[model samples]
Target: MEVTLLLEATENAFRIMEKARAHALGVLDTAVQFTGEQTRFMEEKRWQVLFAGAQRRKTRFQNFVGTALILFAFWMLLSGHFDPFHLTLGAICCIITAYLFHDLLFANVRVGDMRVVALRFLCYIPWLIQQIVLSNLHVASVVLRRKMPINPQIITFKTKLETDISSITLANSITLTPGTITMDIRDGVYYVHALDQKVADDLNAGEMEDRVAHIFMEADHLYVEDVLDAARIYDALRV
Candidate 1:
């Protein structure tokens, strides 16, 4: 009789432990599912806020910049430094340009990307630094040589820039370099006039392409700035 009683007690304990284990696992699974749902929800909300904020800030900045440009034109008009109509027209042009390239001349506006356009100019500051350093050395070599070793030539090269902005930026950067002046841009490729063989070599280096790519990267679009595509004439036309 006692043996049977003990067996019944042991069976009850085993059943209780199994039920406890299953309940704990169920609780853990529920917690994990809840955390995943919450994480996704938060991420979606964060991106929505970020995009909306950028739009608002961009619009406001454009308007403020536009107003400043227009005001400067007004100041020019008040100074009576020439044709008032021309001044007015110039101001209008400035406003239009600002609206077109909002980052350069205007602020906070939903107009076209002025930031990338601005970046092109900002990038020149560094390029100018390089130019100052390089041109001096280049000029010294020519001066020290008994006969001028400079072999000035104009060469054409194609770029891989997909957007008009990036292509323009790359062209401007080339021109800003002491030895390389961009004479023209055909389609997306640039025709560069080099002061010497060294200039031609630098143009061939593709370093400028990488820098321009970095500038475009700061702006928020891929389609307009990637100059690394193999198909672009810039990549194919290196002389």
Candidate 2:
């Protein structure tokens, strides 16, 4: 009878141990799944944070000033109203527009010194105008010719321009020039329709791209140098 009782107790203890082991395994599995989910969430959050920081880094107060000036100038140029009441109204409208849409207007504004960027852009305008005139003359000559030399074709080229503003500027410049139109821009690739081979050749040469790149490159280099200098100064102070 005692041997029988001992066998029964041993069986019960073994069953209890098995149940406990199964429960422990379930708990571990749940913990591992929960940990994995949290890790993924954290990774996503980190990317969001990094994206936000980059966006912040690309914009500045100077962007607002630049946007306001451009808007006001455009308004004045269009309205051509110099009267006090009209001027006041235009100014108010420009301020409101600038306040509301400055970020969008200067979405890729350099975080560097605005004065240098403005000056460089101003210098680029005259050269762009010259190109437009030359293009216009070419297009006119083609149109007036007895036999049309028109050979319409679409050309696609990838650019290394890092800023949305620079890419957009290049696209607009292409559109402004005669015989070539910017059809679409995606993933740093430009789709352009050329009226003739000359336009295609000019675009393929990438002069406009180089000019736009120059506008931003010097400012970006200076900005990076400024940041590095600031960091060094801070470190020296700490020491």
Candidate 3:
């Protein structure tokens, strides 16, 4: 009976040991799984941090270069190579070139490509001239006509635009155009006072929006959406 009791005790101890081993193995497995997940998460975060740092450095470099160019241009201007008229022309040309050719210098940020900007300029210059001339003629016709038929109305509308320079350029263009004037602009909504219904409807229809985007070359590189969206304020009184 003692031998039988001893064998039973031995069997119980072995079963207990087996259960303890299983529990230890389960804990170890869970620990290893947790470590692996942490390692992967840490690696991903490190990669993101590295990428962002690189981008910030690149942007700093671009800003340095842009500033240097502006200073150099001013230096040349002061050196007297270009006279007053020539200086004015040169300055305007410099600004246009900088705006249009930024990608040639600053290669990152995926701002709209320089090639697109160039193409747009090709289209935009002639279009601008045509617009200016046509508007001038329209205003002249109205002024010279026997009856001064004028019906000025203020129209407000929202634009789905997300760039600063482009929108401001658009506002200036609208104000510059004869008979039509921009009365107020807040956010992406513009309050334009048009000489007639035709120009008001045209602005609402997105012709002007598309043109502005095209001129800016849709470069997503700059903080264009924020700058462009917020900087536009034009108020021109139509005569």
Candidate 4:
């Protein structure tokens, strides 16, 4: 009789413990879901605010001024003319160009900072060029081989870039690199045609993606306004 009573009590305790564990798991799932929804909502709200500002019809005078200066500099570089007559004509042309294409000028209000982005992008250019040279040499070696071991395949991957400009930059960089070409980009995904396993593996390794993301501040920025410094860390890691 005592054994039967103990068994019943133990079974009841086991059932209660199982029910408690299930209830705890349910609460945790609900908390996680809530956190995810909140994060998404915040992201959407931030994007909405940025887009609203971009859509405003007011003429951005800063864009006009910056564009005019760049045009003037390019004109001087091409013409090498600094006399009054030439300078006047160059200014006129710059003004006209700025008037017509001011909207296309670099404006990154969404980024909340432009100088950091620009500096990081400039640093990325040299790295990309170096990659191009290395890739070209590799492809040349493959071509020179008697067997011609060229195995082409399309590699597709998703990116975390928040803006179209970043995506376009990444696409162009891939196309510029030898042994690989950007086939297409749709909905934050990129399709690249790689000449061989080496090229495909390099893309899959995501060094370039991380570089572009860093340039755009897609990753965490523990040190503000120190993009070049951050790049140095990455460079060291790569080495």
Best prediction by TM-score: 4
TM per candidate: 0.44, 0.56, 0.58, 0.66
Where in model 1 is the C-alpha error above 4 Å? 1-124, 218-239
TM-score of 3: 0.58
**Full-model lDDT for every candidate:** 0.64, 0.73, 0.64, 0.75
Report how far off residue 76 is in candidate 1 (Å).
12
TM-score rank order: 4, 3, 2, 1
- Model 4 compared with the native: what TM-score? 0.66
Tens-place lDDT per residue, model 2, 1-239, is: 54345545655665675576567556655666767866656655665676566445434444556577778788889998899998899889988887888778766465666667778789889988998898889888998999989999999988777777778888999998869999998898899999988779977866676667667663243343443453444335435
Best by lDDT: 4
Q: Which scores better on lDDT, 2 or 4?
A: 4
Stretches of candidate 2 exceeding 4 Å from the true structure: 1-99, 218-239
| Per-residue lDDT value at 224 in model 3 | 47
Error of 4 at 212 (Å): 0.6
